[model samples]
Target: MPEASFSRGAHHPPTATASTAAASTAAAARGPDGPGAGLLGSLAPLLAEWLPRQRWFAGKGRPVTGFALVSATEILPSPPGGTTPGLLHLLIRAQQPEPPGHRHGFGCGHRRGAAASDCYQILLGVRTTLPPSLAPALIGRPSGGPLDGRTVYEALADPRLASILLERLRVPGRLDPLRFVREPSSAIPSILPPRLMTAEQSNSSVVYGDTFILKLFRRVSPGTNPDLELPLALARTGCTRVPAPAAWFEAAPPPEGPGPRPEPFTLGVLQPYLAGSTDGWQLALDALAVRADFTDAAHALGHATAEVHLAMADALPVSVLRRPQIEHLAAAMSERLDSAAAAVPALQPYRGALHAAYEDVAALGRTGRTWAAQRIHGDLHLGQALLTAERQWSLIDFEGEPSRPLAERRRPQPPVRDIAGMLRSFDYAAAVGGHDTPQDWAGGMRAAYCAGYAEASGTDPRDEPELLRAHETDKAVYEVLYEARHRPDWLPVPMTAIRRLAAAVR
Candidate 1:
């Protein structure tokens, strides 16, 4: 794919005048029903072929059997004088066959009997002839149906159409099942040209003149998105460590009965963009390059984390894990360890020691050691944190681990799970540039971080040694599997931690 290019202040209006002019006119004449029907079927084959190439597609390695159109609507009507271009919105359920010989094990219960269909949000720019600038976003020309011989591409990649969508979001309205909502206090410009952010992985983000960013969720699910939900909750409690949610959009399926519960799928979120801020991951790497002490920054990050946790505990529901829940948690960890060991040969040698770490959790539970659980930054790490030019830390991306199911990510978990993730991230930074830093650089930073956490939350993570250790071991095991699969060269980083952790237990 071509890299997204944008001029700082250019406003590309959504207009097309080519051979598509006739097609656009034809589409406009047919009214709304013209494009909605048969559009999905026409693009089914093309979507199946195109989706896998996208970075955000979760079922990358698997074959897509077919697409089931859950919802389709025309969000933007044809231009006043145009005949060739229109905007079509879709929520498609993609069907993929389960991998052969896939089985569920302990800790893996959350994912057992997983759904075969995954829903995706697609915004298409439909035209009869492709624009020269949008060739890169092409989804292929449909040979039949309402869009026959029409060039269709992902609309968000087009700044003109993206701006149009942003305008729609700036005002609260409903187009059938899709609802565009704006926070009452939000101040959004009616016309700010959008620039697509290419650095995004699982979702597409568009920045409007460095003032606000709209994150369009690709793979969507029922229930509230924690990315918007948690930050909104934190903002309510006067938390400054998170960006306030300005506006958001969602698609709510029609109610089935008088008391029916319709699952609302968050389609996009708009937040004030932090223009001059840098992510913690890059800041750590920069500090490592100069051999600068990152303890201060790490300390601040810990304090921010604790603040968010405390605010979440105040704003959302909290639970105390009893013996049964603790047992289930331990079993889940053991299952993950077994799966990792089977996948990564290097983990087999340390499997017994890892099992002991999980067993320790079970033993602690047997002694009636209760633990507090609440909604947290489910996938916290260095990358999830942002450090402003003023040296303050802000948390971003509360979507949690994208691979996990929606219900699992929303379930309450010990806050230490997040701390463990950050701890592992520190080790990763040290390993990435091990030669430039002192042997205990990462360790020192980790200690300072925990110290800061204890100071802010008034509860030391180190006080719960068994819970912390088991969570850390569980995180390391996950890293081993992830590294082995995605980054073989980085496998040693987590492997080293695994060896030390296992030996410590021994």
Candidate 2:
């Protein structure tokens, strides 16, 4: 798959997420200009305009997207930060749709849904030096509020101007300047306040090999970034599937009584670059290109996925939610289903069928033992896995759902959630992507993966049928909603799964 451009490239959803980075040698060989000032100038406005429209933009991109530079400092003396500022932070603001119904058509011709209204920081991750005009844009500094109302970072234009700007900051010796957020704990640490974007989210600048990714975390409820926490915990447990962590950095304010106390917040993680790795989606696509080989590979992927989940259960600590009475589940389902039914008129026709499945799953939960769940790969999707040409599947990105609170994301849920996620991925691969003729492989692969999960976790398949089925059904429902909203073209993938589930139950 072709890579999306710059920091605007990667996207993970609320309660879910998505990284890689190469070096300068390869960067120079890149097709486009990459993300630069002129790039920023043109791209910035585009981002300001487009970000709000994206579902991933969190609560309507920007609510206000603009820029204000606080300070820019250069680490290297001679070479200025790439074509952008060495250390640049810009505060941004744009309009967002007023919540749900409060919105009225007020923008453009028709109302622009909810538009971002206020502006904040737009931190720059300029490679080497800070740009000149950019400094004037910093907002919320000790000085307070966004400086100049300039919408874009102008510093990227002059290399020398960017240099002097980078020299201004006083980084703490104890802190990693590159680290930016605590959600994805592991990240590439830039100089203190690397490049600040006064936007409404916390982001991580991670360089995983030749692929440089900036993961955006919208909701922040302090502590270690889950991105780092989950992977490291898994690594500590000696889990081999995930992409290994190379380096870590977090930003913290300089300590008291000392010179400059370091900021303790983690912003990003720098990982070992996986240059030409393909995600599971592409991997499956490739495998299906050769019908026979697809089964074996799918089976292996299923095995790997199951192993990862099992290892995950054993590795991270978990918490169990009090089992809700069957009625409670019915109520929740009723609400969700009602909304879904309204959204997709066809669902209203199957309301009875769907409710029956939810009740069964709820009963299973009621009778089963819920545990203090361990940390799970919250957003377990095929896109999260990396496949090398050698065919080794590398599980990556432990950051849980990007939408939920960090603590909630870290909280343990049914281990089945992850398994269901993978299963859904398999169907998604075959149904959505052009990976046909692997129907048998997909079925057999599911069995193998499930079996492997039981074997590794030592949890008997017979012991958790209810939980397993419930999870699968839940995932199927979720997938249906997801596809309906995001990939309407592929809505049938999950809908078929749900209908299949309904039939099986019937």
Candidate 3:
């Protein structure tokens, strides 16, 4: 994938708005549907045709399963183009996941020339109600979004959707295939599978074949997303470890354009298409199989990550470090987890373990630098992290996890969530890489990673080991809930982890 931060494209002509206004008003005055749904429906078919071309659309090449407008509101077109109004609408369907969702609502940018088209922008809802089985893995709130047609977020916070989003990427996030029998295709067939990929779940990423990633938004705060923010900062750091951002397209909401716009932005992101790089989980196992040099690689990755974070704080306004909060932040987390856990059956079995884990996390949450908050890879894991030929680790999918609400993903939790994520990755790496042979190798790799991070970040985890351990444990319980729903086969991975955490406490 090409880097999003560096755009080499030449300038093009600006958009037009005259036709957009004429079309919207004409349709409204034309009574929404003159002949079929009439002119409006005429436009729907046009949009249906264009949707598959979109980076966000799931089944582009295949036939559009269906197109129906849930709601529509008119908004003024971008300025310079004048008062041309366009429809801001929500489009839904039965997509691959059986529940079939939205192709998303679009505010088609001013339709020009002979088309007399009415469109200007798009605002997508980041949250979706899923089956109970898949709910536990979807944790966190959306970090930023375009909800009810608006940009969301104002700070350097974690994405609420992280938990669920990450879980959905696991291998078995699919629903019972037998439930939703295959349907007929209008054009060809739906190439979009029922299973959602991480890149697809977060950013609208697609390929000719093999992989597609979707980006989800919620919270609808106000600012460019970090997926758009951090890569630019990292580019300045000139780090080779991260994936070259391929291509990223934001909903690109018009600000103070010629009119009153409702929808916020469109989904856009394209990448070079990483074909053969080993997944971090696979690489971790591979590395462990060899020498004990995992520490050196870990140190380099630490500096790379630290460098990105530090640079982000300096460059982007939102990347500025979050303010200090109460030392008892863990108390708040425990409370949230306790409440959420009750609602999640998968987490219920380990309720007592959760409470104990919470106490430890609450204790640790008290000691870390309460003010050290900054934009983090909200859902860090062996899966979220990938490897590059430069022998560097790259991070992808910044939309956080989709299952979360937008608000929480935007909250500032301890940076330790990210730290714990890396540790977990190492654990997973050791588990899978060693042919399912349990080994203490993960510990050694984790120690090396910590040392590297501490060496450069000047962080002192030993001072807060208990606190870190507590956080790690709480996170582990959360993982049990995650894998259980998204990848039932992988449930044992986290179940064992929860047991380990509980035993440690005992």
Question: Which candidate's TM-score is highest?
Answer: 1
Off by over 4 Å in 1: 1-35, 79-84, 100-115, 254-259, 436-439
- Model 3 CA deviation exceeding 4 Å by range: 1-204, 207-223, 236-248, 252-263, 271-276, 287-295, 316-324, 339-353, 360-371, 410-413, 434-439
lDDT of 3: 0.44
Write the residue-wise lDDT of candidate 2 on 8-46 in tens digits. Answer: 111211100100112121123233443212222223333
lDDT of all predictions:
0.80, 0.49, 0.44
Q: Is 1 or 2 the stronger prediction by TM-score? A: 1
**Model 3 Cα lDDT, one tens digit per residue, 245-361:** 433333322233345643333233333345556666666666767744566776666665555555545554442122224435555556656654654565566667656765664
Q: How far is candidate 3 from the true structure (C-alpha RMSD, Å)?
A: 16.8
Give the runs in model 2 whose Cα sits over 4 Å from its true position. 1-56, 60-86, 90-121, 125-221, 251-265, 320-322, 325-334, 365-372, 433-441, 460-463
Better structure of 2 and 3 per TM-score: 2
Pairs clashing in candidate 1?
Answer: 24-83, 24-84, 25-83, 106-335, 107-332
For 189-308, candidate 1 gives per-residue lDDT tens digits of 887878999999999899999999999999987788889899999999999999999999998854434666557989999998988999999998898888877899999888889999
